[model samples]
Target: MTGMTAEVMTPKEVETAKEAAIAPKFVTKGVDVYYAEKQALTNVSLDIETNQVTSLIGPSGCGKSTYLRCLNRMNDTIDICRVMGDILLDGADIYSREMDVVHLRARVGMVFQKPNPFPKSIYENVCYGPKIHGIAKNKAELDDIVHTSLQKAGLWNEVKDRMHEPGTGLSGGQQQRLCIARAVAVQPDVILMDEPCSALDPIATAKIEELIDELRVNYTIVIVTHSMQQAARVSQRTGFFHLGELVEVGETEQIFTNPKDERTQGYITGRFG
Candidate 1:
């Protein structure tokens, strides 16, 4: 008989191996988008890992946001927009006839570039999703959801005393955070941010970046950002889009320091977006 020694793995090594074995949260392949005869994205394919931040970077009108919108079927709202390809969430086709758009959107929440809060109070803003989704059967549950959501978004301290105030009354950053809390209230599995800090000051941008970092521990995050620095800062993986196609994708450090594609290097070096 051949002798074999049993191998023991450290906790960190076991966790790493488990993560490597887990399938990506989202798997997109050969995605193409068209709007009124204009092609917006061409053969875009990428995998969004679970519990990680993936940032899509590209110049304006380069289709990064368009591709992001496809993940949640947001493009379906446009009358002339058409998307083709496989967008799988946990191995299930998101575009299949059986998929519920409302439920999908709830599972994959979104925060826009601007802070677009409702006219309702802060409490109402955060509670709306739970109310609509029937996640809370009573007032106490709804209140708890609001409190926990705000806390997770890092806005609880600022808004605890102002729960009854209009959500629009908050400042730019606060409103954005409130919007994040609103999204978080539903307990989504994924959060998609479209240039989430574009309209904010540097300080506010930093806060949002911090929140993004913290949120990834519980939810997969995909952000479309034009700022290379922001992408480098907040994302564990970075994908670069150019001329409606994904040029390269890799670990953030490699994408920034040693790009595999010249186009990515050019864009990173500030030659041209």
Candidate 2:
């Protein structure tokens, strides 16, 4: 299990390493992945800093989703996915055999491109994770978790009066927010969103962007977005992946304005995908 171990260092040790040191909530080093002998990600190395948003942008089939799935070992659910890399969270290697995928998922949550709320009441959806994880002992405790999670997801104000309504009965934006609340209920250390706004309207997207900004105060966020503007608005840093390779990575302003790599420049300038 070539999990993210070497990419990590103690905070004390990291402090002396250099100013460029990541202080990462998670790190990936020399990561390679393949599905049935077809490579999906190649020699990918990057750092995901704590309390910040990192956006992965590129053309389709660039392996952004693959890389995101590797963070929580979600790819393990696929039989053909062969992952070779190190993914570290809070200075610990996460791909080791000893690592618990269930628990790992609890710490590292994910939101999909489409809003796929469970077929249950809104309150049930938000409380599901805590129930499975045994995070709450009684109704009061569960209510607090649900309330806080919904508040963090920015849905409390809209849905507090109708917590018993079916989650799937909500509009697309509300459903998406419910999913966000569901993910938050687990109190994840990091959250991965794969094109979370693709199915949303501009207004809904803006709300999510705002929620993401607020989420940065407590949780590290990584989003795979196709909208360059959304990336610019919601992320502090951007990583551009191309054909399964991470072509460039840097501050969002530099990557969007004055990219260092020719490929990056071309992609940003709309010359090529």
Candidate 3:
């Protein structure tokens, strides 16, 4: 496994692998990202299945977050960042000249590592994206979306009485859940979470993990988490990245119990992280 290369598969091997994999929602081929002269990702090709939770696990600065940002063109926000690859969302190229970055973001929403909610009220924070995207036509529709998003995020019951309160006033855990509610309000095709539980306590983290499992039924989810146990608990598929490259990817159980790459094995078994 030490000599294993990056997805260098024969036609037969590719077909064999496909036999076990679900059809992809996002197809990334030779995806690469560069910040100034430094390369962040190198020829990463992976398929994210629809209606499933796929987790990306790696050490710090190993390009896990960089690669996750590529899903919805989030990297475009950085002036020095340059992306080269074909990232197709449902067979349509996301980086095509005709692609609308705003629409793309609406279709694929993101939740950051920290709970960076707006300085507005909890209800306003949840309603902000839907209003901007014109997802809600009237007050009733807006209210429905807000209610459903918070309900789905497991925060409605806790924060319902305080709808007019500022989002920053909530506890760290509640703030994070509010952020999740905000992302869900847009009704995106895919949800990208970057260490969403990193700032949370065990109870808060467990609740978020439960919400993730429930959300996968309606939306495809891709998460970047540092904790191996969290990945095992929440994700169906797991991808291990090392040194700006994807070392291996497979079913979560297989990746944990029988890794094909030495790097993946080392990272998982506390040999190195």
Query: What ranges in model 3 sit over 4 Å off?
Result: 1-22
Task: Say which prediction, candidate 1 or candidate 3, comes out ahead on lDDT.
Answer: 1
Write down the lDDT of every candidate, Cα atoms only: 0.92, 0.90, 0.91
Which tens-of-lDDT digit does each residue in 35-145 have in candidate 1?
989999999999999889999998888899999999999999999999999999988999999999999999899999999999999999999999999999899989999
* Total clashes for model 3: 0
**Candidate 2 minimal-lDDT segment of 10 residues:** 1-10
Pick by lDDT: 2 or 3, better one: 3
Range of the 10 consecutive residues with the lowest summed lDDT in candidate 3? 1-10
Model 1, residue 207: distance off in Å is: 0.9
| Candidate closest to the true structure, highest TM-score | 1
Kindly give the stretch of ten consecutive residues in candidate 1 with the minimal lDDT sum: 1-10
For each candidate, what TM-score against the reference?
0.92, 0.92, 0.91
Clashing pairs in 1: none
Error of 2 at 247 (Å): 0.9
